[model samples]
Target chain A: MSGIVATIIAKYNYWIYICLMMIGLYAMITKRNLIKKIVGMNIFQTAIILFYVSIGAKRGGTIPIIEHAHGGQSHAVEAVHYINPLPHVLMLTAIVVAVATLGVALALAIRIYNRYRTLEEDEILSRIRGS
Target chain B: MKKLGLLLVILSGALLLYATVDFPLWGDPSSPASLHVSPRYIEKTMEETSVPNIVTAVLADYRGFDTMFETTVIFGAGVVCFLLLRVLGGEEGDHYYRHLPTGVTIHVKGAKGKSLSGEFERIDMLWTPYDLVIKTACRIMIPFIQIYALYVIAHGHHSPGGGFQGGVILGASVILLAISQNLRTALRRIGEKTVGILCAIGVFIYAGTGALCLALGRNFLDYAALASVLGTDPVTARSHGILIVETGVGIAVMATMIWIYNNVSSAGRYDEGL
Candidate 1:
């Protein structure tokens, strides 16, 4: 059982990330509060960040920095294993995208609140339909 | 309604699940994405561009056209907000205030509100000392924040940053100022007119730089042509060109974001003076 647990831990971070992503999506779809929907969106984006960061990770690898000034031009090197830098870079872009999206979404939410005088998703919907 | 919503959601989830079966596994070393341009980019970018950061090379040079469109997308959002929410000039003296029970007060103080003295005084107590403190802090920080933004823009080439990241930081600084101080004060510091002008100017700086390369007898964004001005090296010229354009993008993005936020938050009621 302990060995099985270790195997699962070693291999299943992706599954956990996927689960969180789905849960967030489910909340966004089913929750009747606008703020909850925003929270769900945050969770979904965070899950994507986790997935990207995980991809960049290499087991027992060091940070992706060349040590000396003379670390010459060779893809093959010794005693300097490093994690992939590409996913980390991609994750940085993703973070900026998420923040921008959040800003726009929140601004819309504020506008909706002003127009309908409520943040409950159902209330806003009914008010719109009534209008 | 709940049942239908749940059922539709479940069906969508099922469809998403089906789609995922064909998707590449997370972090697969053999994935097509890893095999393609990315690996080549990683390997050759430093030698080709003489910039240590591969992401910066990809963003500023290799895929610069995409970055241009990304800025345009932001500009479009700003224009849409402005068109949808702008109150025409000369009717600025028609304003009203409402003090909701939730403690969120709306104060419309301007030429429009000159006739509504009674209503204005009624909500005067709501604009307390705390509001003044927050406003003062925003005033003091705006310049420093903008300078820091410029630093981020300039230093992006050397570090884990770039045009988009620096642009967003600058945008957030302006947004913070707008939120803490009143929108009018923030606008006076960087007005809609200036923002609109700067937004165009920013895009022009980016596109114009690329166009300059074309006129100088090279491909679009071949910064090598600017070698005479920037120094006698293609690397230095490219570095100089990228920094300049990134500053342009940062300015445009920051202004547009603040403009959009102001318009959307005001919800077409600019007479309120935010």
Candidate 2:
């Protein structure tokens, strides 16, 4: 029981991300407003970003920037000294993609609003059926 | 429909939580992400490129192709926004401008009145009277923002920023100008055609550099090929190449962001919006 508790405590960050992901999922699934759906999508993207960034962390690691003269000279530096950077790099691109997606989604929403004069999913469907 | 969505959401959430149990501990030094290629990148980055910033080196030099395509994605978003919403040659709606001296309101259809081209546009949009304070602050701040953006781009080798970040910052300054003043002011400084062309040119510069390397009898995107031209050794040539391509990315990101913001916020009308 103590070992199980220790394991859970060690991996608690994953639980945080899981909760966040569930919040986003619930919002995206249950929200009737188109804009709310987009907000949920943004939240989902943020959770993914957080999950990836968290993967790069190290308990005793410094920032990825190497300050001393091991600088350009030697490969003596250890991996445990610096946090993983690949995920950080990948997540940067993911962030840009998220922003672009948000912008495009909002633009599309505006176009729909202009045409249908409503943003609620049920109302839009009803209007479409009536038409 | 809602019931189905709820079912899927709950299933996915449960699956995700179940999967998290198999993951590594938080901030563990022995985690797989840290054990793999990241250590190699950290070890070799400064030695190979002399760039102190590992992320910038990896982003601009090691993963140039990724950054190149990433820049294109933003440019495409800008183009897509314009294509979806642009309505051309439309007249401004009915307007009435107050003559300050005579306190007379001259009503005009399609915003065309006597000497309307210059004077009428001054009152074309509504803004709070206290906007002057915000406008003055923005005017004072824009230059510094632009300078800092350049610094971020130029000093990427030493610091934490690179082309995409600097470009976004640069774009935000133009966006600030538009917000404080008007879209017309921004459109005047950088016309639609210019923005379109500049975005394309930014991508072209990155591709062209890679293509230039190919023409010089090296593999595509092999920056070391331009050693003689840059008057540096192979290692330094790669560093210079990274900087050059990073500049391209910056320009592309900046142009694309401004272009997208202009189109999306205005709904392609270049009319009033926040």
Candidate 3:
């Protein structure tokens, strides 16, 4: 049972992330509320963040920062191995991008609200079609 | 109805699951992404750009053209919003609609002893004491937030920050001001016309800098052309060019975002249809 549990944990982390991602995408696609759609988008973006961060992680790796300057020497001794810093850097930009996209999306939602005075997606569609 | 939808969704999801078999495994060091352009960038970028942050180097130097278009995307969104939702001629009184909240104590400023009638009965409190506190805080924080945003743009070469990150921060601060105060206050501070002009100017600044480099006998975005004026090495010139374009991107993004927010939040108030 313990061996099975370990195997499952090792093999299924990505699957869990994928499941969460699908749930969010499903909500965004099927929900009739604009605000709920935004919430779903947030979840979708957050899952990508999780996927990226998890990729950057290495087993038992230390922080990426270098300690003890080389003091003009060609080579310096170091006891610690550095973790990959690329994904963290990428994630910072991704977070900013996500927020900016969310801002614009929310602004669009507000405009939609003002035009039709309704939050339901189906209602807005029907009204537009009727008009 | 829900169960039917769920079944259809599950069927589609199963199809998607089969598609994932061809994808590279997560964190495979030997994957194509790690093997191709990224490794070259990781090795050569620090020496070429003299910047500690490799991501900034990639964004500002290696793939600067993409950043330019990204800024343009925000500008386009702003233009669309403006066309769709610009408010026209109307006095304050003409647009005001009043309604009372049910089962709540309503406080009237000037109508103390007057009987509740048509206009007075419908008048509810729009600006409350809590709004005042939030407005005051936003006013105090706006300048500092803007300054910090500028710092983030300038220091992006050496640090983890860059144009897009700093631009969004600046835009959010303006949006915060708008939400805490009113649309009028925000417009007064950063008017729509000015934002539109700034958006154009920001794009020009970015594109023009690249053009200048091209005219000076270098590649389109090669910053070595600015070395004569800047009195620095070609490497330093590259960093300076990147910074200039980053500042342009930040300005364009911030102005465009605020403009978009204004238009979207105030839709349908304009009787003059675009």
Strongest candidate by lDDT: 2
Q: For residues A1-131, write the lDDT of model 1, one tens digit per residue.
A: 99887656544666667777877777787888887888899898998898778766555545444233135654532221444566666665566566556656666677677778999987978888999
Complex DockQ, candidate 1:
0.24
Model 3 - which docking category? acceptable
Those runs of model 3 whose alpha carbons end farther than 4 Å from true positions after fitting are A1-13, A45-108, A125-131, B1-8, B15-25, B28-30, B90-132, B268-274
lDDT of 3 by residue, B21-42 (tens): 5545555555454555455555
Give a tens-digit lDDT track for model 1, residues B1-274. 5576567656765675565656455445555555554566555655566555656666777777766666666776677667656665655542434444444455565645254433332223223423787778877887788777778788777666667667777877877876785555567777778888887888778889889899989898888888866666887677677787787788778777777777765564442234
List the pairs of residues colliding in candidate 3.
Answer: none
What 10-residue stretch in candidate 1 chain A is worst by lDDT?
A74-83
Model 2: CA > 4 A from native? A1-9, A69-75, B1-3, B92-106, B110-115, B122-130
Give Cα-based local distance difference scores for all models. 0.67, 0.82, 0.68
Give the lDDT of residue B156 in candidate 3: 81
- Taking the candidates in order, what DockQ does each have? 0.24, 0.64, 0.24
Q: Give TM per candidate.
A: 0.75, 0.91, 0.75
Better of 1 and 2 by lDDT: 2
Interface RMSD of each: 4.4, 1.6, 4.7
Please rank every candidate by TM-score, starting with the best: 2, 3, 1
> Using DockQ as the measure, which candidate wins?
2
